[model samples]
Target: MKTFEATARSKSKVDTYISNFMKLHPFAAFLTVFVGGPLFTLLAVAAAVYLIALPLGFIMGWF
Candidate 1:
């Protein structure tokens, strides 16, 4: 019962903190999803392409 109370208190604190952060930095969140999402996707695609190309280059004697 004490542990459950402590856990609830901890969760409430975290929820309050996140709510404050979102209220203060709504645009930061928007930009993170809007710009950061595509940038991360582009980086992931580039990494995959590089990985695929490396073995192909080696197999084709281009390395």
Candidate 2:
């Protein structure tokens, strides 16, 4: 018999994971989406174009 390993990008898995996160830390989740999301995006897109952080974000998103 084999057990199923969990994955990160599966739709159902992501949904449940997000719901669990929100349930556990509503404020943190909210701040992540509203604050961290934009800050990271801006840092990666504009501010850090010459830095490793921008490319690292793209690589992580691809994988």
Candidate 3:
């Protein structure tokens, strides 16, 4: 019984925190999906290009 009450209280607190966060920073959630998605993709592509080019540059004596 005590454990059940504690779990309920914890869940209520988490729900309140999520509600407050949504109200406070709605744009943050939007930017995270839209802007951050593309930014991380670009970074990943850039890293891949660098990794591929490193060996090629060494072989071509351009390093």
Per-residue CA lDDT of model 3 for 1-63, tens digit only, reads 999999999999999987788689999867876999899999999999999999999999997
lDDT of 3 at 58: 100
Scored by lDDT, the top model is 1
Q: Which of 2 and 3 is ahead in TM-score?
A: 3
Cα error, residue 60 of model 1, in Å, equals 0.7
Candidates sorted on lDDT, descending: 1, 3, 2
* Model 3 accuracy (lDDT, Cα): 0.92
Please give, for residues 1-63, the per-residue lDDT of candidate 1 as tens digits: 999999999999999997888789999978877999999999999999999999999999998
TM-score of each: 0.60, 0.54, 0.58
Stretches of model 2 off by over 4 angstroms after superposition: 1-9, 47-63
Higher-scoring candidate on lDDT, 1 or 2: 1
Q: Which pairs of residues have clashing backbones in candidate 3?
A: none
